[model samples]
Target chain A: MNELPMSHHKHNDPLPETVLRVKALESLLVEKGLVDPAALDALIDTYETKVGPRNGARVVARAWADPAYRERLLSDASAAIAELGFSGRQGEDMVVLENTPQVHNMVVCTLCSCYPWPVLGLPPVWYKSAPYRARAVAEPRAVLEEFGCSLPEDVEVRVWDSTAEVRYLVLPMRPRGTDALNQAQLAELVTRDSMIGTALPRSP
Target chain B: MNGAHDLGGMHGFGAISPEPDEPVFHADWERRAFAITLAMGAYGRWNLDMSRYARERMEPAEYLRTSYYEHWIHGLQLLLIEQGLLSAAEIEARMQRIAAETDAGAES
Candidate 1:
């Protein structure tokens, strides 16, 4: 039952208004017995340690290795993802977009950062940023290029705008020169951005 | 319902600078903000969409200026007030008290 850290207040220099505001809110909520401090810590630890892109990577790798799983994933992503124990809030309705030789899929939450939290942990700052949100839908190719993922002209880029219920996870094509790699090895190559469709998986 | 948070396709926001290796929480406040929001969410007082709409109600200009976690805090405060869990005045008083305590600690 560790308390929320007030570390920022130690220095003489004043902290930002938002910092104090959040601190105040937490204190008030706890004092009123509305929020349990342990619950807060657990939530933080879950995102920071337990859940993350690694979970999504495993799903991607499994789909790549098994055709049946890939079929399941493409057809019913939520069920397929839950088979790996990755299902919760912000991930209730999952859609797995497969990146093939002819098409690339990207995800964005135009309204707010509606990400697949169970699998991806949380959306990256760049994914939630105004520029990325605004430009990804308007200029997918250019946005991909900026992330060092320049696609050829022929590949069709599809951008999925995530709503409150639906979340998207991009299943990037398995990189070439890795036919010998196992599922575990393939999962190692999956980066967060690759799952988000911003960058390609690492080549090994 | 149309707020600055809906940045699907507009102009003038230049260049996406991807930090080489970004930590999940940039600052202690951000971590607390995120956790507190989620923890408070467990009360079942408000659902995900309601909370998001609260954040989306922020002033468009101010919303554009603030960081992600800042928006979370804003939305959290709105929900707290709207749900009758806390008042605006109470939050202000608590913020002032914390500030006074911090000042006292810095001097000691």
Candidate 2:
């Protein structure tokens, strides 16, 4: 369907130059039959609605709830995550970092915004910014502090720079008093930033 | 490539600001840019890494100054031209035409 109508730009204020340029590109591509508008809409809807951190959260929750799944996730993350149907582009290779009492793990793409799109959907704006790409690997402790997540002195911070095809996902430690919560309920506590290692899961 | 995009360990970009409840696409144009890039990519003209390299090949100053989707659009434009799918002049002429139409609508 033609959900995106050009008439939306009929406002009093003019659209930005980049906006018009993208519009022009899309129109030209459609006219040439190089791209389908419906396919474009489908792609947009898939990321905007279908795939996201919720998928990652469910994976983490399963890892926390079932010891067998946890072991599987720890050993072969790509296969285990694919078991839950989260595998595609940007997720062909995955490494899951488990946060324990002694070690804290975080992920960053120092070269580019190469995130696990299948699990986390498109990366957040902050994750793609120059500061995050520059500082996440260098001063992870200071970066964590800015995120309001200050770990204890005893815990070692490990920063995983996603330079190659391997995408890292942080499996945050389970919070206390969540023993009675079901896997779905446990998934509710996992935040996107927690999976990215910038924050911790919400306490039960 | 050691382009402006390779920002690891570099300094002076300032603090990371996380927006609360950030929407998937900041604006309508952003959604279009993201989708168009993905759709054109399905044509098998170029792979993902090639597109990334194209974005990184952008002039350093402009690369750093632009927003995320701006980088994407720039990269898409580069790929379109490189693959001979669309010429630069065609894009520019279409942009000018759209701009003129907007101006005319505003005056009416």
Candidate 3:
């Protein structure tokens, strides 16, 4: 077996070493006719633009505007999300938990960084970090506080530990003073961290 | 077996420092690493679960020491070699050639 490329670099500079290794691998793969650079670009485009938190934001906005949709979203999140055309790997099994006036929901994958990629795109570094992963479930209140999201003492907090079989999306409660905002406008308030249950939607 | 990659609920890693206005790719190389990994993954030879397992299967020390994308490229290399797509000798030779070229460029 080949040794990991990480060991080859001794200097503190990691970015250039990683870049060089990736380039070497890419060139070899292309020369072998196993992969095309165009395919790489397409994959990047799909994640960066076509699929992302914006897709989840649209779903959240629609849910906030339509009580019926919200009901469906809560009842069967996977199907409800699919209704908006977001489904596939890493999202095969999804459960949408809602945050209400009385309770808040947070998500963490204790085993691996299994996330709903179709909606959230790539998981953030913090989301995959050891600090967040280990602490998110242990002290969720403190974690949220660190993210500048403080909750009422009366409200309850629930943490969901994601597994290989199921991933989760947190439907944060719509902020007040936004009843007049349309779905499109509401989407603007739905930040990625809010959907991840780390923070709340921005007030209008 | 549980590995370092399964870091949820553990401790001592450090504070969760959030970078304000962080870019999608911190460095140009990260973009290349991300894109190349995805491109190679498109072959459909291995599934996402397998990829995750590859990263998780590393030694605890190495896994904890390596960066995220480093883990990714490590797993990619391991998978490609295992799948008969590339050989260890070929990879070593390529790295040596790259090192030599870089040294030559620096000296000139």
DockQ comparisons of all candidates to the true complex: 0.48, 0.47, 0.44
Shift of residue B48 alpha carbon in model 1, Å: 1.3
lDDT of each: 0.87, 0.88, 0.80
Give model 3's docking category: acceptable
Give lDDT tens digits, candidate 3, residues A1-204: 133443222212454456667878887998988888788777777776787888899989999999999999989898999999999867888889989999999888766677888888887767766667778888899889989999999999998888777889989888889979999999999988888898999999
Q: Count the backbone clashes (under 3 Å) in each candidate.
A: 0, 0, 1
In what order do the candidates fall by lDDT, top score first?
2, 1, 3
Off by over 4 Å in 3: A1-17, B105-108
* Tens-place lDDT digits, model 1, residues B1-108: 666787888876777767777778777787899998988887899998899999999888777777788888899999999989999999999999999999999999
DockQ winner between candidates 1 and 2: 1
Model 2 achieves a DockQ score of: 0.47
Per-candidate TM-score against the hidden true structure: 0.94, 0.93, 0.89
Give TM-scores of the second chain, every candidate: 0.96, 0.97, 0.93
Output the TM-score of candidate 2: 0.93
Model 3 per-residue lDDT at A200: 93
Model 3 agreement with the true structure over B1-108: per-residue lDDT tens digits = 677777667756555666665555666666777887877777799988788888787778876666677878888988989999998788878877887898899999
Alpha-carbon RMSD to native, per candidate:
6.3, 6.6, 5.2
- For model 2, residues A84-157, the per-residue Cα lDDT tens digits are 99999789999999999999999999877889989999998888887788889888999999899999999999
DockQ of candidate 1 against the true complex: 0.48
